[model samples]
Target: MFGFLKRKIKEFITGTKKEIEKETKEEKGPGERAIERAEKEIREKTKKEEKEKVEEKPKEKSEKKEAIEEFEEKGKKEKLEEKEEKEAEEKRDGLFTRFKKIFVSKKLGEDDFNNFFDKLELILIENNVALEAIDALRENLRKELVGKEIKRKELEKEIENALKNAISSLLIDSFDLIEKIKTELKEKKPYVIVFFGINGSGKTTTIAKIAYMLKTHNITSVLAAADTFRAASIEQLEKHGKNLGIEVIKQKYGADPAAVAFDAIAHAKAKAIDTVLIDTAGRMHTKTDLLREMEKICRVAKPSLKIFVGEAITGNDAVEQAKAFNETVGIDAIILTKADVDEKGGATISVSHVTKKPILFLGVGQEYGDLKRFNKKEILEKIFD
Candidate 1:
C-alpha cells in the first residue's frame, strides 16, 4: 500500500521538477526582467504604507500583540492534543493494525482460532523457535486476528498462509534450493551427514527429523548412535530407529563414540545405505572433553555434511552454540529447533551470518512431522519490512 503512495509521490516530485524547469526557461526570457522590476516597485510601496500605519497608531500595535499571544496559546493547546492523539493511535494501529482490525470485526471464534493455531504452532515450533519468540508471535497474531480488519472473503487457511508468509519473511534467508540440489547430487551417491551439538540441544531429534525427511523424499537413511555418553542417549536413538524402521549402530555408554561412528559408516558402506545420519550427544561447545569427543566422531565419520542443532529459546545462546560448534567441527549447515517460540525472529539472520552456515530446516514443532525446509528469503522480507 505504501509502495503505491511512494510511487505517486515520486511522480508528483517529477512533475514539480518539470514545472520548475519550465519556470526557469521563462525566467531566462525577456519578460522575467520586466516582472522583477514590477515586483520591486510593489515591495517599496507596501513597505512605505506599513511604516506609516505603525507611526500613526501605538494602540494598534498593543492590540495586535494581545491577539497574537491568544493565538499562540490556542495553537500550543492544539499541538499538545494532537500529539497525544497520535501516540494513542500508534499504540493500537501501529505495526499489524490492519490485520487486527479485520480479525476483531469478523468476531473470529475460539474454535476457529484453535484449528488455525494448531497448524501454525506446529509449523513454528518445529523450526527451532524460542518459547518467548513463539509467545510474542502468538500475541501479535491474536491482536491482528481478533479485531475488525480489511474485508476479505479468503478462508482460514488462506489467512494462515498469508500470516505464514508474513512471518517467514522475518525468519529465514534466501535458500537457493535448486543450487543446493545440484550440489548435493554432485556427490553422486551416499550423502553422509554428521550431526553435532551439545547434549540436550536437540541433536538426536534433528537427526531423526532429517532421516524422516529423506524417507519422505524416497531416500534411505542409516542411523548411527555415535553419542556414547549417556545410557538414555543410545536408547533414544534406538527409539527413533524403531519408529523410522531403520537400524541404529551403537556401543555401550562411556564406550568410544568414535568407534561407533566408524562402525556406522562401515555398515552403511556394506549395506549400501543411501545416507548416514550420525547423532552425537548434547554437550556444551565449551566443554573440552565433550568437544574432543565430538571432534573425534566427525573425524571418524568423514561425513559429507555436518549439521549443528541448537535450542531456539536460548536467545543469543543459540548463535553462540552455532559458532562454537562451527569452529570446533566445521559445521556445514544448521537446524534450529523450537522455532515456534521465535519472538523477535531476530536470531535467524545473526546466527546464519555468524556461523556462515545455510540453515537446512526448522524444527517448528515437537512432532516428527513438523519439520520443514528452511526458507531464507521468506524471513528477510518480514523483518524491517
Candidate 2:
C-alpha cells in the first residue's frame, strides 16, 4: 500500500542530501585551494631564508666575535625552525577543522531550502497531492528546515522527521466510531448515519462493513436503501443485509429517497435498533439535483453523523468530492475505499485536511472485516519509519 509514494519520498530525501553535499563541496573548493597555496608559500619562504643565511659569511671578524656571532646565529636558526614548524602545524589543523566543519556543521540556508522544495513540490503533485494540502505541507516543512543547522550525517533523519510532522499535520484528529455510537445510544435509542459519495466508490460495501463492525460490538443496526434512483441499488443493499442477517427497509424504485430515510429511522425507533445506516444515491458532485436530494435526506433523517465515502485511488478527485459534499451537507467524517490497492495514497493524505473533517475508516478490501480504522501514527510510520 502506498508503495509508489513511499519510494518517491525516500528518494527525495536521499537525493536532496546528496545534492546539498555536492553543492557544499563545490562552494568550499576555492577557499580550500587558497589555504593550500598560502601554506606552500610559507614553506618556500622559510627555505629561502635558511639558504640566504648559510650563503652569507663574514671573513674579517675576530675569532671571539666570530665564535659568539656563530653561536647566536645557530640559536636564532633553531628558534626560527621551531616557530615555522608550529605555524605549519597550526595551519594544517585549521584547514582540517574547516573541512570537517563542512560535513559536521552544515546549515541549510533559506535559498538552499527553496531550491530543494521546488523538487519536492513537483514530486507531491506527481503523486496526486492536492494543491492546498501541498501548500500546507510546504509551509510546515519550510518552518522546520529553512535556516536550520543540520549535521550531514543527520540530514536524512531530520528531513524524514520534518516530512512526517508536515504530513501528520494534514490529517485531522479522528474520534472512535464505536465509542461515539455507544455513547450516543446511551441518550438516544437509535444513532442515525448517512453515507455520501459519487458512483463506483464502494459506498454500499463500506456501509455493510460498518454495519458488520457495529454488529460485532453487539450494536444492532438496520440498513436503509435510500438509493432509489440507481438500478438494482435496492437489491444490492438487500443482499448485504442478507449477508449480515440485518433487516433492510426499502421502497420500490423511483420512490422518494428522503421518505425512505424517514421510514428507516421510524423502523429503527420502533424496533429499538441501536443505529440506522442510510445509504444514499451516488451521483456526480456537480449535479445540484442530487446534492439537493442528499440535503433532503439529511433534513428528514436528522442524521447523527454524515460521512463522505470516496475512492483512495482517485486522489485529488476524491478530495474535491469530499470538499463539495462537506460544503453542501457538512460531512462529519470520511471513509476512503480501495485503500489496499492505492499506491499513491494522496486521497488519504489530502481529504481530511482539505475538508476539515476526520477520516473514520478505510475500505481495504472486499471482506466485511476489511474496514480499517484510520490512525495517524500508522500512516506516518508507513511512509517514513
Candidate 3:
C-alpha cells in the first residue's frame, strides 16, 4: 500500500538533502573573507611604518617605536585568535551543534524550505492529493522543519518525521464499528447505517463485508436493498445476503429507495436484529437528484450512522465525493474500498480531512475477511518505516 507515494517521498527527501548539502558547501561567508583582508592590510601598514621610521628616525627611538608596533600587532592577533577559538568551542559542544553550523548555516530558512517543499507539493499533486490537504501538509511541515536545526546525516529522518506528523494530523481518528454498534444496541434495537457512494465503487461488496464483520462479532444484521434505481442492484445485494446467510429486505426496481430503507428498519425491529445495513444507488452524474433521494432515505430510515463508501484508487475524486455527501446528509464515517490495489493511496490521506469524518474500514480484498480497520500508525509505518 502507498507504494508509489512511498517511493516518491523517498526520492524527494534524497533530492532535498542533496540540494541543501550542495548549497551549504558552495556558500561563501563574506565575514571571514573581509576579516582576513583587513588583517593583511593592517600588517602591511605596520611594516611600512617601521621601514619609514628605521630610515628617518633616530636608532633608539626607531627601535622603541618598532617594539611598540610589534607588541600592538601581537595583541591584535591574539584577540582575533581568542575570538575564533571561543566561537569554535561554543560550536563544538555537541555533534548537532557542530553540524548545525555546517548544514545550511544556522537553521533551515524559509527560502530553503519553500524550494524543497515545491518538489514535495508536486509529488503530492501527481499522486492525487487534494489541494486543501496539500496546503495543510505544507503548513504543518513548515512549522516543524522551517527554522529548525538538524544534522546532515539525519536529514532524511527529519523530513520523514515532519511528513509523518503532518499526515497523521490530516487523518481523523477511526472508531471501532463493532464497539459502536454494541454500545448503541444497548439503547436501541437495531443500529441503522446507510452506505452512500457513486456507482461501480464496490458499495454493495463493502456492505456485505460490514455485515460479515458484524456477524463474526455475534451481532446479527439484515441487508436493506435501498438501491432500487439500478436494474440488478437489488439482486446484487440479495446475492451477498444469501452468501452471508443474512436476510435482504427489498422491493422491485423503480421503487422508492427510501421506502425500502424504512421497511428494512421495521424488519430489524420485528426480528430483533442487531443492525441494519442499507445500500443505495450511485446516480452521481445527477448530484441534485441523488442528494434529494439520499435525504429522503435519511428522513425515513433515521439512520444512526451514515457511511460514505469510496474507491481508494479514485484519490481526490473520493475526497470530493465524500465532501458532497457530507454536505448533503452529513456522513458519520467513511470506508475506502479496493485499498489493497491502491499504490498512491491519496484517498486514504485526503478523504477524512476533506470531509472531517473518520474512516472506519478499508476493504482490502474480495473475501469476507478482507475488511481491515483503518489505523493511522500502520499507515505511517507502511509509507515511511
Give the per-residue lDDT digits (tens) of candidate 1, residues 110-172: 554565556556544544444455565665566556442323333333354445444443343
Model 2 residue 203 CA deviation in Å: 0.9
lDDT of 3 at 263: 93
Number of the predicted model whose TM-score against the real structure is largest? 2
> What are the models' TM-scores?
0.54, 0.84, 0.82
Task: Please state the error at residue 287 of candidate 3 in Å.
Answer: 2.3
Candidate 2 structure, TM-score to reference: 0.84
List per-candidate RMSD values in Å. Answer: 20.1, 5.7, 7.9
Ranking by lDDT: 2, 3, 1
Q: Model 2 lDDT vs. the true structure?
A: 0.88
lDDT of 3: 0.86
For model 3, residues 175-241, the per-residue Cα lDDT tens digits are 9888888999999888999999999898999999999988889999999999988888898889999
> For each predicted model, how many residue pairs clash, with residues at least 3 apart or on different chains?
57, 0, 0
Quality of model 1 by C-alpha lDDT: 0.64
Off by over 4 Å in 2: 30-99, 102-104
Q: Please identify which of the two predictions, 1 or 3, would achieve the higher TM-score against the true structure.
A: 3
Candidate 2: the clashing residue pairs are none
The per-model lDDT (C-alpha) reads 0.64, 0.88, 0.86
